[model samples]
Target: MHKNAFAIHGDIVWSKNPKELQTVEGGYLIVVDGISKGVYPQIPAEYQGITVVDRTGMLVIPGMSDIHVHAPQYGFRGLGMDLELLDWLNTHTFPEESKYANPEYAWRAYQIFSDDLLHSATTRAVVFGTMHVDATMTLMGKLETTGLKTMVGKVNMDRNSPDYLCEKDAATALEDTKKWLDEVEDSHFENTKPILTPRFTPTCSDELMEGLGKLRAERDLPLQSHLSENLSEIDWVKGLCPWSTCYGQTYEHFGQLAGDQPVIMAHCNWCPDNEVEILKENNVFVAHCPQSNAQLSSGIAPIRHYMDLGMNVGIGTDVAGGATLSMFRAMADAVAVSKLRWRLVDQNLAALSTEEAFYLATVGGGKVFGKVGSFDEGYEVDALVLDDSQIKTPLELTLAERLERYVYLAEEGGRIVEKYVAGRRVL
Candidate 1:
């Protein structure tokens, strides 16, 4: 018998692809050494005697992923919904992030964030930290103890930010970022690493972007940042990078878009045809932060168009702007906003279905972390055992129907009976 082998019996469900949702009622998922072997209706004879973790009436699905979020903003979520992107940043976000310079405050706040995330359905994330190196490291430390896989960025913004929050200059910002990366290397966190983060074109100068680009090449790390999330923000980027054709072009000029390494840009709500082409060409991961866009009055992202264009797409709980960290909420918001976009903005494109949104929440976002968020053979064993008995209706529900309801109605904590990442139970 394989020491690492185990079996989970439940009503299994997972994405075969973006357009297909596979389900097996009364099935068994075979896992060995943190990798999925397959799902079967009957346990194979070879593994018949292995220990079976029974979840007979529960729903077993792939654990969700959060492609983009800000750790510093977790404390202020649901507070600054009235203001748009720029004003909200100055009024609420900048002030809150500046507090992270105090390591004690960072540890306290990040502990809450980490605890909540551990209890939530998100098993993998690409997270953002403020410019303060010690504070960012503090956040990573808290997350490391949670047994979750994450890439945390120590943000860089040398211009167009508050004096208290901004770095002294491009050189200082680059130096600090390098220092943070070195510390992360030394920390030897098993499931956490550093990502390159230039706040955005408005805040990051050309010199800073250039320096960060070099660091990205040298370290071979992934990058994450904002794109055309709002009209005013797009205009701001245009003013900042006058030589570029579009907002994404500025990042492209600095080799920040996906090519050799993965790049995830949050909230491409206003990307024009040219920018879309550039993003598609570079294979950038477009993080659809629908709830954040609505909360800040940013325009709805053309997610349907992006899907049709065959771009890599995922969901994000943009934290303070989004008001929640539930990828379930993010998935629901993605579907709701796409309906509005299809009905009002452009009738030519169709709205996203519940299964499609589930795909975005799982497989699409999982792509960034490499073969995660699915139960396909040889995929990592990131599984969620959900007891949705409370949400179930009197009428019989198929696994697909139950999953859709879980996406919109199911709360975390109690509903999540067992959460596993890489075959090890975390919650």
Candidate 2:
């Protein structure tokens, strides 16, 4: 290997495309200066003296990305599953998020959440924080130490929220957001960045949205927010913004669709064809939360359709809306939900396959971070070393088959043996 390069050997697998899986047994994955050199069957003679870490029995795959997760909501995951979207938020989400106003509470809750995330397979995420600036800073501070690259947004909601959680006004929301951005800038966090979050159309007033859109333009910041995730939510957006043609149009009207930076919209389950076109035209990234959609009884997203349209798509845990932080669960759930959508909702679309789901969890989601989620020479070396030996099988399995089993069956305990972000080991 080169002077500064290191290599790790394993059963390697990564995505070449949404439908393609690239696997290599006994592969040598070379990393130099926190970037992947290449995966080779043998260490080349030109690079003979570098260190090699032997991860012989493990499977190396790209680190998963969760493009949309609520960091504050992580404290209450797996609770309030019986309620639908609006009711669930009212009963559980708003109340839980409101607790973050206390800096101590934010620290305590975020510590646990950050620790769990560090241990999980996700190496990068776009996270949502509560409206409290100090609490959001607290959250980002904890996440920064985990060596995972993340974008955390302090939520902006000036209307249609509980008194405790909503911002006082659009001006206050904008000012607070600017302050948060300024604080984040001053801190100079290595791995954590700030994102503009507008909550959603129902919660953000026209003025708040407009201000946020302008902030996005001026600062050239990325944004994350909910889209047409539920039918009731869509209707609420319709009534909230009568001048807008569709739910997506309301965001477009206020210039929240896309600016200098890309936008990440969670759960485009109910996006109409026009809205779909708008998302495509604007180059918006969709964060598909399959478990959250099923848990909250929101309609399933046409992810296959999005893929067919060449839209940027990624998977998300969605925290409390989704019950787990495991991207493996998200990958499996994506395929399962797509099967339901194919058989019951729309017969014309093909169900997602294992390869497609894996791609969404990896490279597709990594698009937001730029050149991540794969080991395709020069891609950032964020990866996971999976120990799936606990998964017993009677017959021989292909690398793809083993990955499929791990995606569906691996649980929280001891599945990932090691984790790396930018070729630096984090776990």
Tens-digit lDDT track of model 1 for 307-399: 999999999999989999998899999999999998899999899998999999988998899888899899998999999888746888889
Q: Compose the digit string of candidate 2's lDDT tens values, residues 117-187.
A: 99998999999998999999999999999999999999999999999889999999999999999999999
lDDT of 1: 0.92
How large an RMSD does model 2 have? 1.1
**What count of clashes does model 2 give?**
2
TM-score of each: 0.98, 0.98
Identify the leading candidate in terms of lDDT: 2
Off by over 4 Å in 1: 412-414
Report every candidate's CA lDDT: 0.92, 0.92
Which pairs clash (backbone N, Cα, C closer than 3 Å) in model 1? none
